[model samples]
Target: MIKDIPEDKRNTFAAIGLLTVCWASAEYALDFIIRCVHERYGGSQIREAPPVSFKGKPPYLREAFANHPDLAGYLPQLNEFLEEAWQIAEQRHWCIHGSIDLRADASTFPISKIIHGKEHRQDTREFTARQIELLAGRASALSVNLIFFGIQTVRLMPKEEANKLLRELLRKYSAALPEDGPF
Candidate 1:
């Protein structure tokens, strides 16, 4: 079916693919931050950290970092990244989940989905290749920024405090771990 698309419509598909992949990269970056937060917050291992969905991650990390004084300087950037990341997630949801019109041009690519409620309605939105590309760029930037934030957070933590936290975490999870290891 993809092969049947006309040449003019291929750019839309490509743009959509870019957005999808970029957003995935952003998610991976967020996971890195999750791992850092889990370790910093006395999580023995990532597996021991409670499960959190993508939608819940930003708020959880924001609150966690806000409680620590060392992370104060980075809060502004963290808040900005989290806010933008949330916005991007919303756009990503629509673009990835909505149905596209194959006959539409790249400049007026239409994506629509049915909204279910007391009375159902169709929600349709148009996106140009340029707009999708811009979103992809933002997603890519967010991924890079998240990685830097995690790295900085790790570096800023005092060695003694980190060690103490790790020790406590290991102790908490020790009883459940096998003799060989958590594996």
Candidate 2:
């Protein structure tokens, strides 16, 4: 029965399966982190498990964004970052799970040649690397936002003051540190 199916269709099915697994894993991590922060602040003294499943398109990523109301001002940037990350992850999923016919009509070009050529490859490794870097920055921003929320909810600091301190901490952490004498 499997032998009767077309190669392209088989590859497509494999890619879809891989993508589903990646999305599930990513969502689980996000859910765990959010639940930890929520529980720490709620002061219930009893821990609750993270959600078993996410609902809707890109559920896990959506839930991560949805739970952070305090970071509403940064939503535009966060959304842009997550969208790019998802695209990169999807591309990686395809590359890993789908067969690439190098011998097919679509000729394989070297990385250097593609960039130096008049019409470069539509998707270059460098472009993907940059996207990943941007995604990391956005992830850091999300982490900082979560810290702020935790502080506020736990009453460690007032909202206005916590925001101010958080910004200061972000600036300090983001800046390059000077090299002191080696230990």
| Candidate 2 stretches greater than 4 Å from native | 1-58, 102-183
lDDT score for candidate 2 against the true structure: 0.43
Per-model RMSD to reference: 11.6, 13.7
What's model 2's TM-score?
A: 0.33
Least accurate 10 contiguous residues by lDDT in model 2: 105-114
Please name the candidate that would achieve the greatest TM-score relative to the true structure. Answer: 1
Q: Which lDDT value does model 1 have at 42?
A: 36
Record all residue pairs in model 1 with backbone atoms less than 3 Å apart, i.e. clashing. Answer: none
Highest lDDT: give the candidate number.
Answer: 1
Clashes of each: 0, 0
